[model samples]
Target: MKTGTNNKFWKYAKIITFLLTAFVVILSGCVDEEQNETESGNTTNNSQEITGTTNNQGTTGGDYIYGTAKVKSIQIVTLESFPVQVQVIAKGYLPDGCTKIDEIKNEGEGNAFNITISTKRPKGAFCTQVITNFTETIPLEVRGLKAGNYTVNVNGVNGSFELPVDNVPEETPGSMSTKQQIITEADNGTSISIENESTFYLKLKENPTTGYSWELNLSQGLNNISGEYCPPEQPEGIKQPLVGAEGVHLWEIKAVSKGNQQVMGIYKRPWEKVTGKEENFILNVEIV
Candidate 1:
């Protein structure tokens, strides 16, 4: 009975040891499986992140790949008391490969500039706002211009358009019309018949310091000719053969007779010592 009990005790101890060893082996295998799952999950997440980053870079880089862009159109809105709008279509393209990135309201010193006009005033006025990487619409006010034709220039590019303004009279307050008159009389001294009366004036310039005097001779056809005559003289009444004014002096002559007669008048500005006649500087008059 003592030997049997001892044998039973040893058999139970061996069975217990076997069970414990089996539990340890199973636990180690489970731990290794868990570690492998965690490492695999981390590798999958890292690969996904790299793919996403590469896709975003490709989309952004493709935008400027071709290196060509165009300005589609330009519009102007006039913001005067009355709103007037104008549209312009651009025929040419802009710099190549310019992709629109962003835009905003602009307020800076170097951005503003002045436009000069050779005429009275500009046909249109406006404030220009700029945009980056994209086409933009501008605004303008039309004023102080005629309702005919006009042009607008941006940088060096030019465009033609029309303006809507009242047609004001071309004559201004200070503007003066030139006056011109021409009178010719026949040789008949008894009765003077006016031949031509045109209001057109000619240029007359003379220098009287060199003993130059204009002579008026009456035609022999008329008699009893008389009128007030003003010979060319200096404002200070300085005699010829001396320095005088450099302008033609005006004179008036008239004649009357009982019978029909012819008269002639000649204006002579002769050299002082020389006997030959000097050239006559004609006068022009304009009629109103």
Candidate 2:
């Protein structure tokens, strides 16, 4: 009874100081819920390392911005006079999801995208010894590529190359060059007649003096008449009759077509008048 043992030791020291202040307020709410679950698992592992390696996916990394593109340059000049300068460089890469597209060059027929420089020998004709041995082919099309990696730059004269663009297909329109078969014949004749099985012949002679001469006939058979005659178009001292021998005469004959045809020719005045004589005669026919 020392005073009932000091009021039972201050009621067990205020219940052990209120159970150690409720165990430090439940250990500061369990360390603030384990520091908000370790800051939400480090923000979900940094958003899964930015959506696992990004190259346009992960919303862009390499300064990503999708859509809108154009890179075009093409030049080819060959009039063929032969000092031989052939330079052709073409490049076109458009990838931004190709929408409502408007322009793209070099696509003129079958497997379209062409650069041809040919030489059997005779474009401007001058070859002592320069045949370089050339061949070039580049065909490509790009429209709305959205699957990754695209870069192309092609420059000529052997300088500039950087090409790597993938997957782009769906543009078909290329194939042309077929409109060449013109046969026009009209004759009011003092002497002119031609029947064709059709090997190929083009002749126009308007006699009065040599003004036109063009002949192309490779030869097959039956009534083939060769031609040359020109005179009388007046050009100084007017006493002319010697330019393959007489005016308004043009002839083109090629034979190798056989079926039914006739050729007869006659233009007289040049059995003697030396210096370059004139007088014509030809009558060749085969009709069977």
Candidate 3:
């Protein structure tokens, strides 16, 4: 009976040892798997952080990042007046709600204009993943350019426009074009006939240094284009122009309608009340 009891006790001890060893092995495998998963997650996060820092084109005010805008289309609009004016309409999209148009730069070379539209957004700010639409109207500096076909590039979108004539005005009396007509104070109180849609210049003498200027009034059939003050010519030996000297007040007018038109001017200080004794000039024009 003693030998049988000892044999049973040894068997039981062997079974207990085998179960403890299996439990330890399983626990060690679980721990190693968890560590490997944690290491892999950290590596992925580090790679994303590096990419985010290197992809931006630039930074603004140490808080914003700059990127190029995505332009979709462009339209060219030309005004219907002298010394032609051109405007460009650009349409584009933004990547997110937080992104906004930052700047627009235009550089002209030869007959081509290159325009850059830039975008800005706060760095690392959470924004809606929605697309936004944008439109911008920009004017071109075409004053000195000769008449021809010109190309415009706005953020890689291309367009073209044509200027049938030079976009420069007749600035001097000796340089007047065939289409420009001249009138002086000597023509006041006289009636003249001109072609329809013709442009005329009214040159009058005044002394603005005394706080007096020419106030012009146009009839409904005419259009007052522009008025400018021409300073008196300085003597050859004199370096500075004469003070309180006489100057010419030049006005550019257009006859848009046929029939009778009138241009009237009154010389007086703007703050002073007008009286019948104030000097005045008038002209009658017939457009046919």
Candidate 4:
């Protein structure tokens, strides 16, 4: 009877041990599945965060390329007033919708106004591939400039404007005098007499873009005070003058002594040898 009881106890213990082992295995599988699911969710969220950061950096950060805009033309507008007010209108097209005007810089050096127009776009970004037209009107600082022809370059597109008279106000000292005379192309070969120490002006037509300018030859008793070139004036209802148009060269001269003074001008390029076939202007002056 004791041996039977011992066998029955062993059987029941084995059955309980097997049942415990199966239950532990099932519990371990469920825990492992839950852990894997949490890890997968974390990986997906991290991927989204990384992608968002990259896009934000591309748009608002310093990840961009610099370029120049394609300028088609430029219009120089002059206001009719003393100390001329001038503005330049730049017309161009952007290569893509993503491209934008980054900066515009202008500085006057001698007779040229250099304008730099820069553009920027996001790096490695997809954008609309359509061309966008843009117009920028920029005012020029012409308060201290002398009367003459001035050239403007906007992104390599060239245009010119003229200051017909000195940009200074008429009330400025020595700006106007009663002893001054005006000379024009129509006055060529004409004899004129003026008082000693008197001043005179000569306005001659010239086209520097063709490499031709008026070379002046002044005789004794005459002194050249100053000179400047002025581009052609824009007509009424006209936006701008054509590129490479003819302009005027204004020369101020003073009669120093009383004698016969002859003025001669030859239109030719300075680098070329003087040929008699070139155009010439002759003037005779008598200073008393």
Clashes per model (N, Cα, C within 3 A): 42, 23, 0, 3
Model 1, 216-273: lDDT tens per residue?
Answer: 4434322222333233433366555336434443333222323333333334455344
Please tell me which model should have the higher lDDT, number 1 or number 2.
1
Off by over 4 Å in 1: 61-288
User: Lowest-lDDT window of 10 residues in candidate 2?
Assistant: 77-86
Clashing pairs in 3: none
Where model 2 places Cα greater than 4 Å from the true spot, the runs are: 1-8, 22-28, 38-219, 222-253, 256-288
Pairs with backbone N, CA or C atoms under 3 Å apart (clashes), candidate 4: 148-229, 149-229, 149-230
- Tens digits of per-residue lDDT, candidate 2, 130-241, equal 2222123343342333333323333212222222332243344442213211121232122222333433232333343334333232224543354555344445675746
Error of 3 at 129 (Å): 2.0
True-vs-predicted CA distance for residue 255, candidate 3, Å: 5.8
Encode model 4's per-residue lDDT on 1-288: one tens digit a residue: 999999999999999999999999999999999999999999999999999998887677558889999999888877443456788989999999899999999989999999999999878869999999999988899987888999999999999999887787567663443536667766778977788888888888789878999999999889999999988776679776556766888999999989899999999999999879999899899888
Query: In model 3, what lDDT does residue 244 have?
Result: 74
Q: 32-57, model 3: which lDDT tens digit per residue? A: 99999999999999999887776653
For residue 206, what is the lDDT in candidate 2?
39
Number of the top TM-score candidate:
3
- Candidate 3: worst-modelled 10 consecutive residues by lDDT: 53-62
Please, what is the whole-model Cα lDDT of each candidate in the order they appear?
Answer: 0.39, 0.38, 0.86, 0.87
Instruction: Estimate the lDDT of model 2.
Output: 0.38
